[model samples]
Target chain A: MTAQSDQTTANADRIIISVDAMGGDNGPSAVVAGIAKSADKNPQVGFILHGPEETLRPLVDKRDVLSGRVRYCDTPDVVSMEDKPSHVMRNGKGTSMWSALESVRNGEAQGAVSCGNTGALMALSVIRLRKLPGVNRPAIAILFPSTNPQNFNVMLDVGADIRADARDLLQYALMGASYARNGLNLKRPRIGLLNVGTEEHKGRSELKEAHGLIAQFTDQADFDFVGFVEGSDISGNKADVIVTDGFTGNVAIKTGEGTASLIGALLRQAFEYSILSRLASVLAISSLDRLKKRIDPRRVNGGVFLGLNGTVVKSHGSADATGVSAAVKLAFKLAQSGFAERLAARVASTVELTQDAVELADPVPEHQKEGQA
Target chain B: MTAQSDQTTANADRIIISVDAMGGDNGPSAVVAGIAKSADKNPQVGFILHGPEETLRPLVDKRDVLSGRVRYCDTPDVVSMEDKPSHVMRNGKGTSMWSALESVRNGEAQGAVSCGNTGALMALSVIRLRKLPGVNRPAIAILFPSTNPQNFNVMLDVGADIRADARDLLQYALMGASYARNGLNLKRPRIGLLNVGTEEHKGRSELKEAHGLIAQFTDQADFDFVGFVEGSDISGNKADVIVTDGFTGNVAIKTGEGTASLIGALLRQAFEYSILSRLASVLAISSLDRLKKRIDPRRVNGGVFLGLNGTVVKSHGSADATGVSAAVKLAFKLAQSGFAERLAARVASTVELTQDAVELADPVPEHQKEGQA
Candidate 1:
């Protein structure tokens, strides 16, 4: 029938997502398994695995889920986590990470996912895809897991650049709102600007300026702007999107990770402190497992590099198959939603474009005549 | 017979610690309970409670621990948490918070502790006791719990001044190291400068200059200098003192508090999910209580403002009797150790004093500064 033919054609022309299948803590096998798992769950998704053909082909073929939907690019080199970004940018032509980005640039894939070095991946993406129009500094956005199981709070400028002016912050707010709409299915996300104190007159001068500019966009962007949130609001159920300069956001992320690890270690110590405690741990382990599942960092392991011409999801370097699968699924969703083009359109519609770094500088007015006493 | 008389006189002349007892969330009774608890454990400690004698005398008389070591400094006003610092400074003559600081300034007490408004307490202390000669901006230091049970890792510039230059950071290192030496009994504490990256080449220009300046003080100051540390090292045992500008430190501190609170909520939810889990929680209640006590925020409830002429410990405004007792204990330890004078001497020993905010501007010659050419 005509319906069967249409379905075959649709399957043949599936959305291809590229993957750098090497350089993660777990080797190429984990990457292949992750792709297979994603492909099984998502029939409309296919992969362009970028790694050595000999290494990837056998691992990929073992999975019945990835029979006809997989493709290989036959890359010779792997971008190791220890390799410097500058070095990779200059000398990494045939690396799997490089090939994956190239696939995105060549339009063979909608986006790319990499489990290699974050710095290297970012460098390669910037070099290949360039930045979107009206974006001064490209920022990395991440979904912070919240109380709501179906949604997450979006935070931007996580670690892309350490500095941000009022203009850059304004761009981040716009970009982050667009992301929330697409990724978290929010029609109008609430945005908050992070600061030391919540009082109206607190924080630095730049933050004050940013606050006014962000407030002006609430009506136009169809979002609610909650002014001057503190560090406590980042993890709590406050705003749907939290914005800050990269330096503060990056430090906060690392600190949260360290604290979570510390708590986990302390829990082990508590459970093993005595024989009776150990017995209690056995009975309570299932409840603890649910709690652990709720806060698992691996479930939300990808950092999306927003404001770029093409989307790139950077998986954690230490990710295993489960973590890698989570990242791949995120990439697939972004590609499926046509998020990059929508983001570009939204940014283009905004009037304020480039940063005012040059325009705002006082170019000491033309040789004023002074009267001597 | 001479030694016995001296002991009697020494008991009568115990070190007097001034406290603002009116404005804590738990009220004057909690403050009285805390002072009594401290007095029971420390016979050499005496308190000068500043509040209305009519309201406080009955509470003080209720405690057997406060029978002989208490003195009342009745004040007509109480500095509420909502009182602005500037308003308090201009019109807070007879306030209990003001009286406590005045006692420290007049040498009637060695140290002062308050669970009132932090900004008001700081303003009053700076106005009355003055800043140390070589100190440009004072900082608030706190002890974060760590791997070693005997000591804690010191973090400074928690929320005193939001801005800091290279010299200011170096000064924090010196002051934080001094605090570690006195508070934790570490002879030569290891110091680490907080940064976005661990590499020497990373972070802002001011941080780069601070790194070189701190390196020069290892032998003269008697400490180990770990080059640069990321946020993950804050709780880890990488260094004894972690120094940063106040803005970053304050945000990190609040973020840690928020995250810890979130995990606590999640843990409670996990344990209450079912009937069997609730029974397991009953059996494991003691172990969990010990774990909770180990990480209790109330246990370490004081933040000491360093680099001032007199030491001031700011307790949490909502502290209960146990929390107040912890703050009083910290105040007693600092007063007993004569930390203020030793810190002044240490700061004076360093030749590099105030921050050079203006002198270090634009070292590059004008000839190289081409714009339109």
Candidate 2:
């Protein structure tokens, strides 16, 4: 316990977070609220909320809580959630979101958090901070709600790139596993590829090829590769880390969110139908509360974009104050963990090995394929 | 209310159902229990439970209720949930699942319900029932739990074909809309194409192309076309029928299932943590019950395989007696509505119109390009 306390203190003192004050539904209010809550709890951490001075000043002024530690950076433009990705990347100079990214890039802040347009943020992060060496496309990793409160599952490429090859999937596995280990404080995280089925030939050609690559690496991989997992296995905690392309991951996340809300609404309606059932519902209130907290979206607010040179966290655009605060805390923890540096080194080593293997398999000409090796 | 009752009674009598007795966790016992319950309430409906005679005889022997209406078909094999699709299709001749499908095809039953291996069942149905002329792929459509109890949302291609083109999605929209009108008893079900955003250019190439087709048809089509919908919009009943490819749809449905279960588990834990919270939960029991009834998986047990020549409902493999019974009721509703015949005729007409339009523009290809022309 003492060693854990010391590590927490050491991490808190070294971490600096840059929050996009103009992002999300509640804007600077939620961002400021989250920062205030986090700062109050962790005295060693500091924050810089980027936005227009006039809009952000009052929110911070209302809270005398972290007046000294929480500072502000002025940026006139506010990027709306509906903005086009290319437009945001090209014209978002001096904007709050861009400035927040700049803070991480320039080393003024160790990490950044945003609840703005995901596409814009991804474009800006890659353009500004750049991808880690040997990483072709940076992927976003989200900790999806699982049955076990302490055993959350991480899904990668949750709307980063639409298309990914076998190599990209392999990189996602490595990055996601690393995230589970460092960010979630898990040792040798169990990784699984999200496929149509557990069978080797169950999915598309790309997945079949990826299965081979994953299988090859898992035999001697650094992490504990648990093999393929299906959609139903996600909530069952079949694996600590689940990896997939952005398209499937995005759809899966959205589906889970929609379904949970739908069920919750349905349960509410059922309880209201009759007086006798209402009485019975009262008897089952404890059971209901237990379910709510387990699937509370706010409790797991922040999702990190992996394979980047620095830490960048994305909160839901519709996030409230509590959600924003959680994002800030996540950003702080990630930055303090020194994950970027460790991932950079690991990825670099993997790339080197891959390059050497490719060179060894040097091809002859296309004409030689039929008769020569 | 009197008119609705009369119509429902008339509709119930015309419906014929074939149930797979060897399917599900509890097999014939649960199937028989559910059948007994339904048969007792609705004397007009007919049922045939297909399975091995020895295994099913004892389950039905004790129950005197609807003994005449409930008959059996001797089948040698049973398709387990985990059975390989190819293996089952090739080796499992005269299986309970195959025979149930065959009953529908032979006109002995209007529709069939199976709580068996979903993939294997789907494969058998596709091969035996055959697809409607002009239809490229058959899709699975399930009514999802919605925030509105009176109006549930429909999602298609939950686990049918993995790769789908624009035309297939267009077919899904049409079939789903028809199902919504018939199954949910809606006058004009609003159709929405599920994409990443409402923007025309937001999704993948397939979505972008599908969006154009939807826009063109919705403007002059028979149904109420409400335009695009996101993953978040599914639960809100923003659209009565939401259409997408099988892969995306399956992942989304599973995600929703997992998240709901996770949330329920969490709420239970919360209630058990302390006596005070448990007491508070009791006070809110009525609300919880209301919510549970609305989201009950059993209520929406049957999923229709659209674009097929005949009606086929895929019941959940893990379904209990209540769920199997609900599937039968849903299948009955679908058959009585004459939804398949109507949908078949509609598709035939649309395909003809599409072909005519293509032929008319064949001589002047430039005129076919609407944007340029």
Q: Please report the candidate that would top DockQ against the real structure.
A: 1
Q: How accurately is candidate 2 docked according to DockQ?
A: 0.40
lDDT of 1 at A343: 92
Q: Going through the candidates in order, state the TM-score of chain A alone for each one.
A: 0.89, 0.90
State the lDDT at A237 in candidate 1: 76
Residue-pair clash count for candidate 1:
0
> For every candidate, what share of the true interface contacts is present?
0.62, 0.54
Q: lDDT tens string, model 1, A1-373? A: 0011212333466888889998898899888888887887888888888889889889987998888777778878999877888999999998999999988998878989998887789888989998888888888898876654444678888888888988788889989999999999999888999898887677788888888788878877778999988877778777888899888888877777766767777888999999999988998998899878877878887989988888899988788888888898899899989999999988887744332222233223344312311
Which candidate ranks first by lDDT, i.e. highest? 1
Q: Model 1 Cα displacement at B144 (Å)? A: 1.8
TM-score of chain B of 1: 0.90
Per-residue C-alpha lDDT of model 2 across residues A1-373, encoded as one tens digit per residue: 0010212333355467888888688767888888888888877677777888788878888997766665567888989988898998899987899999988888778899999989899999999899998788899998887653346888888888877887788789888878887877877777888876676657777776666666555533478777778786677677888888888888778877887776766666676677765775676666666566556788688879988889999998888877887888888777777888888887887886654333344445667555644
Q: Which stretches of candidate 2 lie over 4 Å from their true place?
A: A1-14, A267-294, A353-373, B1-14, B219-221, B276-287, B354-373
- List, residue by residue over B144-206, the lDDT tens digit for candidate 2: 877644457998888888888877887887788778878887777788888767777687887
**Local lDDT at B278 for model 1:** 92
Give model 1's docking category. Answer: medium
- Evaluate residue A68 in candidate 2 and report its C-alpha lDDT on the 0 to 100 scale: 61
**What is residue B112's positional error in candidate 2, in angstroms?**
1.1
